[model samples]
Target: MGEPAPLAVAYDEGAVSPAEIAVGVAGLAPVAFVLPHSPHVRKLRPVLSRLGRVVQLTGRPERDAVLLRRLAPAGVLTFSESLLRVTAGLARTLGLPHHTPEVAEVLTDKYRQRERLAAAGVDTVRCRPVPDVAAWEAALSAVGLPAVVKPVHGQGSRGTFAVHDRADADRVRSRLFDGPEDTWVVEELLRGRPSGPFGDYVSVETATGPDGTEVLAVTGKHPLTPPFRETGQFWPAALPHEDREAVSDLAVRAVTALGVTTGVCHTEVKLTPGGPRIIEVNGRLGGHLNELSRRACGVDLVRVAALLALGAPPPPAPAPPGRVYFQFNGLAPVRPGRLRALTGGDEIRRLEGITGHRPYVRPGDDLPGGVGSVFMDLLTGDAPDHPAMVELLDRALPLLRYEFTDGATTWVESPRRAC
Candidate 1:
């Protein structure tokens, strides 16, 4: 038999790791990596080279396409939100299956995506763009109070905030817009249920193609820490059968409206009192979901993504999870500082239900504060039920201790006790 064509990955920092990609496409196709020039990429070259042929992007799409074509790749895909459009362009240039350039643009640009969803009647959240400080007031007035303001192009809730009143809006403007010229959007906040065992938001993980969109799983989220930083996520969100069906229906419609005819999509939806509302549709796989899905239900979404990229038929929906698998992120402090110590790591790892543990920041690493701050630690495991999962996190999280210093002062802090 002839050798399989390679799958080109538009690689970047914060995307899936080289090891994960290698495992995902094993025995299915050879792998090629396309990376933009950056110091991070420089460090990644050796690691990536061990996995596949690596090509550095020349900053021009057409030129990069020519270089990628040399690999004779059968398809192209990306796990990074920032690389979706470029990857789409490459797929088009190579006549490979992927999101069209237009679909990719909508997926990356939050304001444009909101507009497209509203116009298509999939959603009608009032949205306004804030190009600069001059436009903040007007945009706020249009969107009304209790609105959400976030960068037009951002992920990880880096600059996302809830503006409940004029004061909150002013703070968001000062904190996010004072630095440089950037675009942002303000939209009406979808009102979630007042109280529930779960967070008000859930994400539908799906794979779409010519056959149709398949709902692989619905992920449950932990409550946001201030502004809007994700604390963690669990797979097979505990939802009533009807609510689950409704969420799945809305997610399928959202992807269809956004012109997603191929590839996997992570659609974030708010479970509000009124109904399910889309937070946004991401063109790539949601961060860390692949591992969570696999651990929970034996579904390897990363492999599914690779297969879809190669124009293979979509796999059947994953069977219902036997246990509730969770990944809880230990959030950093809300004040910027250099980490000095993180205690109890050994204890947390040895906990009964603990399956895996990884520290994201170590002593001497500078950690950002606010909603933009990343997780300091990630703990993964499964539980017998939803309540049991919550109980596991409650017990395990308090074990970790953190100390930080900001030149003049040092302080010890406990991880945020939520979810």
Candidate 2:
């Protein structure tokens, strides 16, 4: 009998769970998961163990490369931005299919990505890396007011903020610049559509391989809070056909410019009056996008990513008519406090079009307000239509509540925005 097809997934603790991809791949072929040993990953091991063998990853890329070489896996894939370079290095070491390590580096660093996009004639906002206060002032000046300041190598919007004026810039600098002279990028904020309900931004999900790139789906993003925290996301975003095409075109250009010969990517673009501008090109699928796309369209992006990793062609991205809208709402607290009590999970589950519900924090956990942090749980809803989806969330949100203790004050508070 022929030996089992060799495949391995380099795992990282990311915003979206890796279970879907791992589970989907396990069904197709025997797989191995390589990840760093940590308490958080330890808890996930048992659940992932059901899907495939789990291997402890040494922090060093060379060591991990040696291990992967021994496994002799035919393909390797990783979803974490932090691990992209390392994965590319290992893939190169194994003489497997992969974009060069330099390309991987370009994808993770926003400044490098913007540079490449500009060189390729793709529309991009003015951005520069600020390694110190001198460069920070210059970049902010060049970018102008209403600029975004973020770490050069950051994800999940951890050290990201919008600076409206000098005071805002000072605050952000003071907060983020204290870490041994870290690098940050300052860029002009891309203008969103004036009349759109939510700020006009969409992510193009694509699967690129030896054959070429395929546009899987375009997902829309909701308005963000201060510091650009995602409030919610829904699929089948109301966009004009031309605008969608424009975004897709730019995504293809950006991917090609960066020399991404193979793999899955999530490219974000914001529609401006002039045209569509590239927000950022992500090396892997966008967070919560895989689930949203699956419900909105009959396409499983996790499976697609896995197939691409194996140097196989995935099924064409289904263009199912938008019959239902799938939305993921961020359930985040408004202030810092200790979570005393929470409720409404049962009621929320009973609501119509409820596809999935999860609470990430437990009672007594400290709530730190940020992009992904402010929330203890995520609520996903599926509705027959967009308006109905909004209505369903309105009704379901009131039932869920959070009780927190700040200093001597204990109060029950609702999340920032309902689904």
Candidate 3:
């Protein structure tokens, strides 16, 4: 075979950073990276050392394009939505494929995505903008109570709220949108626990082509709470025969449902005993979970995604039974106050099943963002099994700590004990 294409990966300097991916081989193709100046450089740089580095936002004209030019990568890969949006036009001009900026904007906005899906007759929540009293009132009537009032365009599930009553709806909307004619989406909350009902969940970890989309792996999600914000995923889910088939089928349909081509996707769905209902579709890799799948199942989604961006064929997918256990150290709530200190960190290094561990906040740091459990994938691995993996991850929970105080309040939404 001729030389394979070199690839460029967008290195995120922020949370859930892709810094933890292990570069097992130079087998697929040589790789290069476009990196943001990151606070976690000491921890992150080692992960990308094998790849070429291109500094971004360096005050150079068309700096990203200039960097991409230097790397001369055969294909481009990016994790930051900001990076994607900022460089999309140039990438397109150079005929580098990616989720289009238009698609990115659409995917970012639940309301916009609903419009596209609705036209396709896809069954997602009915969505609308709710900026003020009148609009919120009208949207509630349209979407009904128990609506999901979140930013129309948002990430990390930040500022997401399931509004079950007028009081909460009014309050959250007022706080989030907070202006006349400001936009937000009120949607009929599609409630489905990812794994419990189906005994497994489906996420389409794949790339799209003009002719049809390819499903790289139809991995299953382990049981998690509603909205599944923090629960870690276990690869090769302990699912029954038919449920696995159903997840695959639904993912294919959802991709068709989105009219995508040559892009990465993370579609969340619940397979109720009744049937499958898609929670939402994301136009990106499924975060650290994707990295975990790579370690456990031996698939390189980032590599495949990069190749697909160049219209190149991806390497054959990895077979299962590779490793039965993959888990995130589940999400945990940080106690408020400037991080006075963190304890039990050695626990992460010592754990048997723990393949990866990352700390987004450290001692002497301030907790500045809104609260949610999963800021990044803190740990990953192939334990003997799901329950065993969970047991090991549970041990790392106490070693970490975050303290922050500004006389302002911050709330963390981990499972009860994680607090």
Candidate 4:
């Protein structure tokens, strides 16, 4: 006779928007958003208020937990990696179904996750931490050359780079250490196949609950530009039956080793010459892949995550995708500049297999590059097969052009041209 108890979502800027989450859970259960006190989140208050109760966090876990307890939520969950620990702590305090605090800690800290995986015999990869400038050399020595140096806790490849030799290591050290108080780690790079139709890595999207872990889909990635900047992703990676099973099995092992027995897991695995190695395990939804999942298969992962948080049974495995649904992000120039103009959007939209196009940055907006900034452009579309999808992107990407100015000089670049 009464409305179902609301699911308290630990909200932040993440893969899914507040509006999208609200839409996903419509008619299933009400939602109560627990947001941090920040300008960006404040702007979302009005929108969140319309859909459900909004609980603003005061930056204190104990106090915030007490405040959230008043809602008497049926479950607690978060879609942001940064909020995992706090959300896990709150869920524990509230006696709800979610990742334990230890699991959250491992999920957010790359170095720690590697250690757990190595200890559990899931996959062993040498990694060393650089807490400050003093530790960089020792870490480099341990990991050796041709390694990846990345933030101990980061996403979107914001502060990630590859070191082929001493010169590259020195540059990464100066760029990362000479400025801010940050922590980083170095790990031996997993060598992928020299060439392939698909990128050397794939992400396994999975859901785990009372019935146990189920692999939802294997997402194929576009090759990275330089130091790990993503260009695009498509659903149902065109892998042979055995290769798909290999990556999927490794993903499940990584998730189980990380102590995730419930909720969704986005496990990124690098397909190396030797075997599939764990890139990292994120205890949240992978960004942008949700749209592809919904389009390629009939599964809305956002809805699945929400229902799983409410202790519902995991839905049946999604049927194999009928076509290759892809989303490509045109990366911004790898230089700090101001956008003056962007052209050719209309032409890109008309390309075969292209369905939607949206520009994330407007003219005059500051473009801070170096990180894998997908803020320049986004295009979503589908194709009959993987090769066709690749060809479609190759044709569509070069149409759009970007004009930007860095103080005195102005330059025009296209997706095919390096910035």
Q: Which candidate gets the maximum lDDT versus the true structure?
A: 4
Evaluated at residue 224, the lDDT of candidate 3 is 44
What is the C-alpha lDDT profile of model 3 across 1-419, one tens digit per residue? Answer: 96565666666642234433325224555656666666655456775674454455453446656666766667666665545555455466457877666866676667777777767766655777875556877888888877776666556555667787878876775576443326677887765544422234566576676546766666555454334344556677666667667766777676676656666677776665567666677777776655666676666666556557667654455677645656554443434455444454566667676666666556566554443444522555666765565565556655544443545764333221121
Q: Give the per-residue lDDT of model 2 (tens digit) for 1-419.
A: 97686677877776357567765576667778877777767888887677777788888877887788778887888877777887888889888776679999999999998999988887667998898777878888888989988878877667678888888888887776666437889988876767334656778888899888888777766666655666667777667788878888888888988898888888888778888889888887777776776666756677777778778864566774455566555555556778888898898898778867788788889887554434567788776666676667667777878888887898886654421
If ranked by lDDT, best first, what sequence of candidates would result?
A: 4, 1, 2, 3
The models' CA-based lDDT, in order, is 0.85, 0.76, 0.60, 0.86
What does candidate 1's lDDT look like per residue over 1-419, in tens digits? Answer: 97777889889876467788898888887888889887777988999999998888999977887897788898889998878988989888989999999999999999999889988998889999988789888998888989998889888887778989878877777886665538989899888885455678899988987688899888888887776778888977878899899999999999999999899999999988898999999998998888887788777788999889888777778888878888888887778899999898889889888998899887999987767648888889988999898788888888888999999999987665453
Which lDDT tens digits does candidate 4 get at residues 251-347? 9989999999779999999988898999999999998766787778867888899889888877777888788888888788898899999998999
Deviation of model 2 at 23, angstroms:
2.4
Q: Between which residue pairs do clashes occur in model 2?
A: 332-375
- lDDT of candidate 3? 0.60
Better of 1 and 3 by lDDT: 1
**Model 2 segments beyond 4 Å from truth?**
15-18, 179-181, 371-374, 416-419
For candidate 3, what is the TM-score?
Answer: 0.78
